[model samples]
Target: MGSRNSDRIPIQMRRRKCETVADMAAQGWDVLSKCQACGLVMRVNLKMIAKVSGPATSLWNRKQRCRRVGCTGFIEFQGRAPDMHWHETLAAPSDGEM
Candidate 1:
């Protein structure tokens, strides 16, 4: 029973790798918005874009909200899985925490 449960968890995680924002209402990924010219960073509401663009759009090279008088940067949208942390991803056995 333990083995079976472990097996399903991996499969579930794999299924959640829905890269496209196609399912706008899906609650797994978080989008981060960053501006290069103004150094502005924030989380954006994708609901508006998803509705207009049919939810299959990637925020990869989008430009928005940087209308400052002298700012001339494009907003970069990045989607990331909420469950992953950089430190936990890999560790050497010598690190001892493992």
Candidate 2:
């Protein structure tokens, strides 16, 4: 017999792993995320680490936010050093808004 839907996988396992903004920048990656609840998109600047974390900004973590007028979406960013150019997009669902 096959496993039930609820038993197939844990809810946490189905969710994508969250990464810090700094991690993305270090890997030469920038994130363009949009809110699933609203059609709000934001560009997270991982490059801002130099202003706070020093020259080796790639080793630091930065905070990111959604620019939507009333959106309270936020994400943690800890960019990693990458050998090639990288860009990523993510979808955020406002907590309690869904």
Candidate 3:
């Protein structure tokens, strides 16, 4: 007699392993810190490190909102450094402005 589904332990174990790897990859970048002055949020790749600091800070706290009154440019934490052109968008506030 041939092995049936009940005897397919190796197949089931392989499937479980694949699922675990997929789950790990899915847990990508999570917000880590925020700059209160500019409302810029910093995100760190969670899966990269085994442990993370700043347990007191909430993940959502790093979410950046639109700086402009009506502009929809939401702040985001990028893994790599941004290009020089991107910095041009940040307008310097005048002496009177906060």
> Evaluated with TM-score, which candidate comes out highest?
1
Q: What is the lDDT of every predicted structure here?
A: 0.50, 0.41, 0.33
TM-score-best of 2 and 3: 2
Q: Which tens-of-lDDT digit does each residue in 19-58 have in candidate 2?
A: 3444455446545545545646555465664556654442
Q: Candidate 1, which segments miss by more than 4 Å at Cα? A: 1-16, 24-27, 61-65, 86-98
lDDT by residue (35-79, candidate 3, tens digit) is 445565544454443344322222221345646565555554322
| Full-model lDDT, candidate 2 | 0.41
Q: In angstroms, how far off is 20's CA in candidate 1? A: 2.3
1 against 2, candidate with superior lDDT:
1
Off by over 4 Å in 3: 1-25, 29-32, 39-41, 48-50, 54-58, 61-98
Off by over 4 Å in 2: 1-19, 49-66, 70-98
What does candidate 3 score on TM?
0.20
Scanning candidate 2 in windows of ten residues, the lowest lDDT window is 10-19
On the 0 to 100 scale, the lDDT of residue 19 in model 1 is 30
**What's model 3's lDDT at 35?**
45
Candidate 3 minimal-lDDT segment of 10 residues: 80-89
